[model samples]
Target: MSNSNRTPEEQALMTKAAAVLPGGSLGNLRLDEEHAFVVREGRGSRVIDVSGNEYIDYLLGSGPMVLGHAHPKVIAAATEAMMKGTTFFTQNAYAIELAERIVEAMPCAEQVRFVSSGSEATYNALKVARAFRKREKILKFEGGYHGSHDYSLMSLAPSGNTPFPQPEPSSAGIPRAIQDTVLVAPFNDLNAVEDLLDRYHDELAAVIVEPVQRTIAPQPGFLPGLRELTNRYGVLLVYDEVVTGFRLAYGGAQEYYNAVPDIAAIGKIVGGGFPLAAIVGRREIMESYDQGSVTPDVYVPQSGTLNGNPVAAAAGLATLEVLREPGTYEAYHARAATLRNTLQRLFDEAEIPAQVSGIDMMFDVFFTEHPIVDYRSTLVDKTLNRIFDNTLLDNGILKSPGKLYVGACHSDEDIERTIEVFRLGVAAVRDA
Candidate 1:
């Protein structure tokens, strides 16, 4: 598994990164030392490492580079905005235009409040929900990752099997008191959600969830059921569409699923591969952020130095413009569906017990026969999954540890090559 091809210069940089950066990473893509390599640049559907090795990048900057890295339109827009000066504390034209586009696109977004990252967007979404509802507790689905915030960390990756409606902090340093303010429920389970909502609806401000929880698609009626339950209980429904935003559809998961939320946190593709995210919602609920709209006690104060940076907004605008073009999603989804289905067939043909989970546009293989309907079901042979990922990496197909993001930038040739690699990965797992 050692990367013997590492150049002297790349090796030196790796050593330097190890000396300075924690775990030699910026808190993402923690690869083994042997397989890890510093990226030089990305273009179209490929990334070249410092050692001059090229990889077909299915990770796509963790699902933001839908049009691929260094797209001419995105680069030009960002460059023009950068030339005009990057950040301003005051509202800018680009941010305003972007907000208007989001309002038109998202089913739930009557108004928009920009933020710098998905984490900040979700945090503020919950805060505003609590403020608007005048409640304290929030319910989140188990293993539904909204962000790195204290509330999001609850039940993110609990080692032990905790009981229903109870949360186990996934990370250290989260205060024990914070656990009481948060509740956890299994994704795609309507009965569990209804029972919890019935018992704790009075204390709950919002029921936040990912419409597509990680790679697991919602069982039919799940999203609609959640919407009905949240409405019946008088609790705000917040959709964390950071990964699914523009990638799923122009209007995001809400539009694709046809189940609108009271509030939504959108990022990833909306930023066009930049540091930007937003909390968007209906006007009545979003008014919590406006000091003048609400009393001081109920107003939720939120701001960031780089919130709605003009450069990021311009890139997002350009990205959305491309996404709005007719047939864009049709082509993107068809190509990705080809790859996803082909991979599943390959694994099945090889007699490897696997399930290629998630939607066509984004998915990954689980080396298990059990259905991947919820978080607990996702627990399977980690070693086999690692081997499969490494096999793809060795063959110059790069993907995230959990999911493979399919981008519109993937060419016909790129998909064909990846299919070849997928066969190799399937065989590797079969042998293992």
Candidate 2:
């Protein structure tokens, strides 16, 4: 890391975190400068920074922690699990129980294989799709972040006639060959996908899409159209439900939108804020990985030394138990509606070209008069968007800056507080 890139405190942690983890992706905003707010602890919708500043946390760890930081139920479950021996490396009862909850929650998830993170789930889903279809290419939407894996890295530039959409690695160190096997299409542009399918459907194994684009909602019929079109093309459809799973509803956005995919990759709230994820789909496809199958045509070997770890499964089970309650989703919808509407009205009254994009508990504030229907539309007015992000961060409210996520723990008071912050933040940014 550059000296210019690191603050004294950041420099110390960067040295440690980099030595251990890949010095995780830093935001585009100058983190060490104005935007750097080191978190110490959290309770409900508020997080306290190291400096002892309490901020209403809308970032929500980039959309996990939906029950919010250290919910009593989740914490207790984790503590109990920890006390009962952390990792057994053997199948645990909680694993089966959590999988049962997932199967019940996601209408499309018939059989599930658990993993540690969203990236692993999405990556494994790609492998399953290929094995099922016996194809080579994977069609992905531009700017759709499935994971840090090779195939999901291709990003379409904000320009026209994007060609040969091989995986343009989103990060350093990914092999360039990934770009060749991965194809890119603009989100919501079904015709563009058809154009590519004309030449490559036979070779295309799967088409993965975020039912609701992260930070943006899909236009009506967009997701169903994608499902229909992919089914028509014999390409496996994978819905990346990492952000929209329980956050959208008990059954996820696929069920909420009534667009069932061949496979579903889920993360976030499923683990009760623990490190867990899943790739779930039809019985036929998932059964190919069953070890005892005679002459298994597609031998899919999936093992995470920590796959289906007991403690995480226990936490996940506890989280889903609460989410499954009657009217649980209803409360999330009502609260989200209040927050989105209040923010939208604030932008309107301020005469700012800002719009809130979300459904249920997830949303993003785009600083544009026009609606952000897809990734292509997200790039317009980049300057104003940057200004809007900085102003909100400066006002002692914590949002993702890319996409702010509301949670089950975000109370009515939190909504009011966020609206107040948004009003001041919007005005401050507009003037600046």
Candidate 3:
């Protein structure tokens, strides 16, 4: 493997980062030494590295820059808010306004509570569910990623062939007892989920899922079936919309799929590239967050120092305003569809055993002939994927390890350029 062109300054920065940061990364996007490059700044749909090499960025800061990096409105909103003050730890107007916007957009959000990250949001959501339902256990899809909390880490990426309804801890330091609290089921398999619910619904406080499991879109009726099963069994349904929130639609996955959940942990685009997240749900259920409204044992004692940072709320509000503009989704979806379809067509014509698995806005090529419906089905050629991703990086196209996040800021030119790189990536995989 050849290292891409790297300037001395860039090399020095990487060396410094490797010396301090764990595994030379912030534990998000990790590239091999050869392909790794430190990003200096991002504007619109492109990010510039310290080496002054510019790449059309499809990672979009892991799906937060929906309106693209350094958006003028988002910057202005954040800047204006920052000038007033950063954080008061008390209720601020920006946070209240942002919460109102969230309730207005999300179908299930009659009440909202802010957190600093998606992990906190999911953790608190689960806590509230457990409190509301008076149950200790929760059911999550095998591959669904809610966040890095102990409950969310269960069966997130189990290497072993763990059987249904039995969770294997995906991370170390998680207590053995945590395994008993989480039940696992296959994604997109309604029968499996229903069976698990039937057997363990009494113990399950909630059934949490990613509306789009990683890059794989939920099968039609899969979400609705989950809702019905959870309702029938008197278990709460939770949607981890950290990625899909405000990206799939103004109302997130619930609005896009027309299947609402009882509670949702949302982040990513809702934060407008900042570290902000929220747990939104029905008024009755959310009452668990209010200490005065609930019994001492049932009330969730949740508080974060930077939970409702005014600057992040301001940025989030600006992002939502832009998304609400007329014809935004129509135009954005059309552009993404064109790019996704063209890539799939290219791979098919090349006769490569690939499946462009995901919705138009977010997707990646899985180098397998078999259909990608669930987590186990996704165990395909990782080597081929590495080659394809590296090829795109070499050609100035930046994307995440598993998915390509198409942004609203991707211009016609960016799409065209990305498609050309996709062809190169496909050919590289085919030849390999």
Candidate 4:
């Protein structure tokens, strides 16, 4: 299905949007005019465009809508909390409860500090690590996205062979000094990380990584190796689990992989589709956030007005309760696995040279025969990826350009329709 014809009202909105917003869109997505749409609303694994065209939503609000759009339980919780009041600058009961839940659920969390976004969580996690260790430099993996902060932007999507441990700034405004503070290494390459730790441990505060580096699963021994080396170096290990937390498992990647880091940043599902994120770690490490607990020199001053919005926390608590239901994860995994395998099979049967990469819960096609083990390897067939994703949109399937995020609310009908879309998508790619 090419995009349904836009109504006059929608066309006017797009024209208005073009005049007002940068790039005529959100920074996250830019679609061709023929395929562009403004979402009217979303419900249970589906989104309707302003033109009244419904799409099977694989984007899932970029991976936060795990229970799908407007889940009843979350709505009720948030609505009730909204009735009470939106937010208070002072401590609130719901935030405390949510903090308790995070500390209980996250393997690395003995204490937690709330924040308003995943970017803030990662930035604060790094700041706390620096405060604790009295060190300035941090090591992050190539292509590991930790958010848009200056330190996190280093080598996020560098295409150049800049050699190991050299930071590459993908964005322009980042100060040149940031390149000196952040070191880059390849994901899943233990030897490179060991070398960097050996040489720079004295100045390094921590090593931050995405355990599942943007849909590229960690190789056996990788996470353990990172934990061991960071521990040995007396440097912190921070897992940027904003995408993987609760999405991967109830306790996040540290629990799923059985390799715990010193601190972790969590977001997405934990917020129940709201703008809440958290930084969690061991009690001693977390003391940096408590001015009274830490010496003046090492104290981290962090405060946000909406850090613990009652409505957001109530919705998150309700979401976590729903996720705790028996067999919920199994069902979610099973549906995702079915889609993953079917898509892989579709590509194979169509004789298209592609690899279905990532875990069942979040995966996508890499249009190449080569195994996708790192960011550099993923560069192969980049053009094909663009074609395939655009084809999916043409067929009424909405997914992120990089990953297809699955949610628990997908019905049998949704599954069947998505699978049929997969076949058509692959075939279009095969012919293209």
TM-score of each: 0.99, 0.91, 0.98, 0.98
Angstrom error at residue 67, model 4: 0.3
Q: Give me the displacement of residue 217 in model 1, in angstroms.
A: 0.9
Residue 143 of model 3, lDDT score? 81
- Name the better of 1 and 2 by lDDT: 1
Taken over the whole model, the C-alpha lDDT of each candidate is 0.93, 0.78, 0.92, 0.90
Tens-place lDDT per residue, model 3, 291-410, is 889898789989999998999999999999999999999999999999999999998899888899999999988888998998888888699899999999999999988999999999
Best by lDDT: 1
- The TM-score obtained by model 3 is 0.98
Residue pairs with backbone overlap in model 2? 166-179, 167-179
> What value of lDDT does candidate 1 attain over all alpha carbons?
0.93
Superior by lDDT: candidate 1 or candidate 4:
1
Candidate 4 clash pair list: none
Give the runs in model 1 whose Cα sits over 4 Å from its true position: none
Candidate 3 off by > 4 Å: 1-4
Residue lDDT tens for model 1, 304-410? 99989999999999999999999999999999999999998998888888899999999988888888999999988799888889988998999989999999999
Show where candidate 2 strays beyond 4 Å. 1-32, 156-161, 164-167, 294-296
Clashing pairs in 3: none
CA displacement after TM-score superposition, residue 14 of candidate 4 (Å): 0.9
